[model samples]
Target: MFRVEEPINKAADRMLKTVQLGIFNSIIVNRLWTPLQQIKFFIPTGHGTLLGTWRRLAVCWFAVCGFIHGIIEGWFSLYYDIIPGDQSFLSQLWKEYSKGDSRYVIADNFTVCMETVTAWLWGPFSFWAVFAFLTNKPYRFVLQLIISLGQLYGAVLYFFTEHRDGYAHSEFGHPVYFWFYFVFMNVLWIVIPLVLILMLGDSY
Candidate 1:
């Protein structure tokens, strides 16, 4: 169940902002697919032969990262002030995700600034990295290195800040909420970026 500290109508004016946004209840009728199944959709048909499986997967990872940073985190950067009480699909998604990190529900300052930078900066860079790789740009590895380093830095700060707070933002040990939502989800940013960085090092 999605819960928050604020009243449902606390941001009545902001509710108007999401009138056109569809409700998640009606939009998400089916169960989510596994990551591997979803990745198939991101593989570029023209580039598939050139990319091979691992390279295609890496590109798909950047595509996913771009979507999350541009669309999902971008929404947070815009409407975070109204999230706890907002009823839009994205708002509801944030509320659900907040179960693992209550800082989102409350719109913590650090989270807001971090996500804003990520949305504006890394978001577009991620897409550019995809394009660079697909077209075989001379600077693809440089872009990859910058983005991976930035993601690594941001992710480390995210975890470190939460750790300093004694993990008060989450349930800490709840199997799904803590382990899957908080740790596992954020850890991907750390692990994948680190691997990409190492790959860049090998290429040099």
Candidate 2:
């Protein structure tokens, strides 16, 4: 009687264990096959290829602009107070606008203009956005969000820090132009090549 009861109990135990595991797996499968999950994959990997390409291009563009800005900073540091004698495009423009007298508002205006321009250019932010979309990197999403916020922060800084004393006129200038240039320089040029590589299925 004991031996017969032992076999019956073991069979029941096995069935219960099997049923528990089955239920657990079913839950997992439901989670995996949910509409949200499918849509997430579909947007990045399937039907949104063009948007992905644009995003990659944006990243590459900003990277280049960042490099250019880095060079300009280095040059500015080395040549402090000694404006370049070169008649290159930027130099000529600087000369045209920068009257050497304090009453002319050249120094103050120049600082205000550049800070506002750089803030608009916000290379890091544009690159981050494109990178997030193209690579589908979750970290990229966080970085992109940070970049957008940083641009806003930069704009505030440009106004509060550089133009604090009301030395510069609080009127219409190149804010819109700066915004467009910043986006174009950082995103359009930088991210396009890498995006093309992705299209070709080559490792970046």
Candidate 3:
């Protein structure tokens, strides 16, 4: 079972009062299906596509990214002010993820702005990239390059800002919170995007 700690920043006390977070178990439940279920739903199961395996996986990645940015992060951008107190599934999900980075619960300025940009810009573009790839659009690689670059840049800023703050937001070395949630999860944005950028360069 996972437990939420008090906000690390004293300035967050006022905001924390409005939050009614509960003890989160490793398995988070909501009215909707789990994230894995959602991902499975998005992933193409057929091997009939003209695209190769790696290309199909890339398309799946963008589809997942679109869902996350458009739906999940979009909710955060819209309702972050009330998320701590809100018990909606998406809100609960964010609350759960806040265990890894409390800036989300406190609605830190950088987080809010960054998520807003991600939701509005990259969200739609992700879906567009998926569509372009599936349809074999001439500009598919262009979209991939742009989206991958944005993701990489944003991810760099995300980590660098946390480092600059001396990693005060969450427990630095905790297994689930620090290593899995904070580092491993966010690092996908960095590593995968870097790979896609390199692949694009190779294609040129």
Candidate 4:
């Protein structure tokens, strides 16, 4: 009985590994990218090129982060609802997050238009930016700098607008979420993009 069970377990383990490897190849190879190519994207060709180690890494970070963010805010929230007229869980989640945001609750015409435009614009730009950087395309950092500046501008305007509404709010939600996720997230977008802009300028 013990010997028979041992063979069954070994067979099951092999089957599971095969399924996992297949899933990995399908996701990475067919859609996202090849592992070898992704790895190659990380290595610097030289110091002066735009595809240098540090610049590529920074652009990669911006592109990937924007890609994930774009899907939620740009596609699900704005585009999906506009096209097929479907309001999804993703859009609802954005509203849930917006309860903590003045732009949603403040009832101002200006914030309404601004927020709507940004959401629609960011989704496509984010995807394009990621693809551009990964393919070693030019102007990646330049676009990133523009996006970062927009992010910083929006964050500042929203914060001041929230304050003026007599909310006296500094955090996005609770203290921990507010500081790390909300405040720090916005700050780094400003800082990193500016740094990359300077680096690129020097490179040219």
TM-score of each: 0.76, 0.36, 0.76, 0.56
Would you give me the overall lDDT of model 1? 0.77
Give the lowest summed-lDDT range of ten residues in model 2.
Answer: 96-105
Residue 86 in model 2: lDDT:
52
lDDT (Cα, tens digit) per residue for candidate 1, span 48-92: 443555555666677777878998999999999999889998888
Give the runs in model 2 whose Cα sits over 4 Å from its true position: 1-80, 84-86, 95-129, 161-163, 168-204
- The alpha-carbon deviation from the true structure for residue 152 of candidate 1, after best TM-score superposition, in angstroms, is 0.7
Winner on lDDT between 1 and 3 is 3
Residue clash pairs of candidate 2: 56-191, 57-191, 57-192, 58-187, 60-190, 60-191, 61-186, 61-190, 61-191, 62-186
Best by lDDT: 3
Model 3 off-target regions past 4 Å? Answer: 1-49
In candidate 2 the C-alpha lDDT for residue 81 amounts to: 41
Off by over 4 Å in 4: 1-37, 41-51, 75-88, 105-111, 168-173
- Candidates' RMSD to native: 7.6, 27.3, 7.5, 12.3
Better of 1 and 4 by TM-score: 1
Candidate 1: segments with Cα more than 4 A from true spot:
1-49
Candidate 1, residue 168: the lDDT equals: 92
Q: In candidate 1, residue 165 scores what lDDT?
A: 98
Q: Arrange candidates, best lDDT first.
A: 3, 1, 4, 2
Residue-level lDDT tens digits of model 2 in 1-204: 123455877767644644654465456445533532333334553344433444444354444434433344233323324444655543432332232212113334445445435434544445454455555665654554454445445434444543454533332233322222223323433344334434443322
Q: After superposition, how far is residue 172 of candidate 1 from its true place, in Å?
A: 1.0
